[model samples]
Target: MQGINRCPPVKIFVGLLFAFALNVMVFTQIYGQEAVDSNIISYTDKLAYGVDLSTDIDEFIVSGPDTENFHLVTNNDVKLTLRLNYKFLNLSFGFSPGFLSGNDDDELKGDSSFTEYQVNMFPGRFVQNVFFRRMKGFYVENTEDFVPLWQEGTDPYLQFPDLKSIEWGGYTGFVLNEKFSLRSLLNRQEWQLTSSGSFIPALRYNFTKLANTFESGSYGKENQVDLRADLGYYYNYVVSPKVNIAPYARAGIGPKTSKYTLDGVVDKNTYFVSDYGGGLQLGYNTDQLYMGIRGSFNGYTYKDESDNTISNNLWHGLFYIGYRFETPEKLKNLF
Candidate 1:
């Protein structure tokens, strides 16, 4: 990679603070401007604000140029995301702190002991994990086989000091008939459905980026970028005046790119990705306040056929509670 600059943990936290403050300011401004006519209607009640705490389980793999050898990598990420909505517009931003846990990790030291064993102690390290070893934040430690793989005066080992990364992302979307959090409650008043279901379609997009692993002598970096668009439908069934149960299904495709560096050589590739799944949503919605919980399971895989031999399949589970401000259609704007 050209350089190694770790994204401090503060970035995500600061971003969250900024997003929340901006939403608060927006709410105040909208409310302040409503003095023009308390009885006259100028704008629809089209605003929502909320936050979500989520966990993402990410899995990865490494193989040779021809995709011969295979190794499994995984990460557990926890995030705090903030969301805002106005009319058909939707926006969300989130942050995930740095954490590392994999093969040869030292639980006591909270670092990668793999670095010392592969780079410092092992003598014949050049023959093992050749591709994964040269990654930005990874190092080689000698296992003390006592014989150097290369000739005398040759040192193939490097130290990266640390091997951890932080991740952050944002999302934007358009809802045709309904939205999350706010829509569930509004639909109750608009349609006056006593019991039954209705269909709502949504268009969604999201992008995620993470810092590279290694510190120096890197060609490129190891990180991911994914952009997806999906048009999905949900059926909302009202169980009670205060509760609604919904079953949702969606299928979408996108491009997922990953970058890796070895010996100052960069291998960056973008693979066609596809995802499909369904889930259930339960919420308590009203004109002034709304609260809800949702759960979903999804499956994703790369379009590259070469990975078929290996288990490149990935899946995720989501559970989050959402709370948002709601305004009565009769009262007008939510300020």
Candidate 2:
């Protein structure tokens, strides 16, 4: 780790953005049109654009036989996102604007930043997603566990201002039932007129890097790769012609390969990991406008040698409003 950077370099981030843009163009050109069951699903064939306001809380819990459990968490923040959807391609970019008032109270929790780029494609019954995300800065969440008789309001949590994490991953899957439309629940380019459900199985893979600027650390830097098979059930209940409620749950288990660097030496380890998540979404859609809110909780856990375990848990909420309109000839031809 002598020459390695603590975070992904600027070049890699720029390359990822370019790759995401390239995929958006290729997918829109090739998979822009597809046939589906007319009764169960309705396609507008129009371009949709929108903005989303989201709030997320993420934390990591570490436990060992000899040490007490402690939590490291990022500062809670609100994020802004821009989204565009045309036919099969759905692309979004999210970032935290420094102007947001709440996150600036970093004196207690430390400062943090988050950014992500994601692309989703829906072709008939198949779904594909690719995403890259970066997060930096964290502080101890359970300060009481570390400081004796610590007052919550006055005491500052232990901060790791140099900690950073970067992850990139993708998943591909297909819908089991043709009657159920996953597109209606996700991108909102299609409308589901009837209540239906489907079983989705997908293959997911990701690479993650975790590092800190500390010169002498037990785990100087860690890189991990995970490949998992996930099975999920999604159901949409159409209460009215323009309103729907959807619920989804998923679980996955897989093997993780991790490489840890310490004092110029490297150690490799393998562990089995499990993850679970469930969420609810309520949406209202019309020919030209759409709005929705969603809430979800997700977590994954892995045990190392001798009962040492680590878990990452996240809670997220999102609200979005958007409009759809006929695709202009200029925009379609340009891509």
Candidate 3:
């Protein structure tokens, strides 16, 4: 009884500590800047209009003692995403809407049930300087999913639930030379999913010049290309997610977050799990807009408390297209 009573206080204390730390960091950055440059180049000065469309298809097969009777269950999913971005005062704001759906079926019978998922995200960013940049951002995501279950001699049914996730983070980047840069991001994500929270810390190296040099100075000519690689850890409730299978095909890694289970028991020991993958990035950027696509392949093994292990693999893709408009101040200069 006493232990239960103590939980609330601990949570409150931690929450307050985090808030204080965030406030301190923000203030320090704001005050540390020497002064606002009158000659600063803002994103509004390079405004371009664009649009992006993307779709992904993934298939997974799960088999084991528990799933053997079901005889090779296969899951297929597809997602479509769209986004828009605008710049003002050297800041950028982006909004993305996505639709996803999938089906699970018996490999032999091919008769299966379907599930649906949807998500929308709005992320806003503030950039301190255009040449050397420090960025801070906040994002909120809303998601909905429908899960279907089937019982023998009974009709298959669906369960629909809506979920929300929020993240606030900042990235600081240093241009090491002209073509290379180092970047780091710290983000906190809270999900309505299972009442879970995750903290992600990532470090990336940017190869910005290699891809940009190849394009011509046309309307859609690419001004910058980033060949980025990152290593990060996901700290989640009761478990830490690991990146095990590193895919090495593209210029950058794709979504680094996933779930892995072994046997029937959830494996909390990092060494006992293999859950890692990498991705590829291809995109074009103009003065006003940036568009890109990322694709990744991931594999992991998970165990239940019952000592059963399940292996899963996923191939996912993301397409981002957006337009950036000039700020009012920059518009004034154009006229």
Q: Pick the candidate with the highest lDDT.
A: 2
RMSD of each: 14.4, 3.1, 19.0
State residue 299's C-alpha deviation in candidate 1, in Å: 3.9
Task: Give the poorly placed runs of model 2, Cα more than 4 Å off.
Answer: 1-33, 40-44, 215-219
Candidate whose TM-score is highest: 2
TM-score of each: 0.48, 0.90, 0.36
Worst 10 residues of 2 by lDDT: 1-10
**How do the residues 82-133 of candidate 2 rate in per-residue lDDT, one tens digit apiece?**
9889865687888887678757768888888888888787655678887888
Candidate 1: worst-modelled 10 consecutive residues by lDDT: 116-125
Better of 1 and 3 by lDDT: 1
User: Can you tell me which runs of candidate 3 are displaced by over 4 Å?
Assistant: 1-52, 57-76, 84-272, 329-335
Tens-digit lDDT string for candidate 1 (1-335): 23556444344445554554465456556544323122112112445565665554433434444543333332223445555544323345444334422332322112221110010000110000000111113332321233346332244333333454333433333333322322333222122134433333333333333334334534434566667666456666767776777777777777877775656676787888776777776666555455666666665556443454222333433344444344566545433
Higher-ranked by lDDT: 1 or 2: 2
How well does candidate 3 match the true structure in TM-score terms? 0.36
The best-first sequence of candidates by TM-score reads 2, 1, 3
lDDT of 3 by residue, 1-335 (tens): 01111123234434533553454457456655222223212242334443334333322233456543111222223333332223221222222222223332222122222222111111212212111111111111110112235343343322111111112222322222211101101100111111122222333321111011111321111112222233333221211121111123212242222222222233232213444555654444444445556666765555544455644455667565555564467566643
lDDT of 2 at 289: 91
C-alpha lDDT of candidate 1 relative to the true structure: 0.42
Off by over 4 Å in 1: 6-56, 61-182, 185-229, 255-260, 268-270, 303-335
Candidate order, lDDT descending: 2, 1, 3
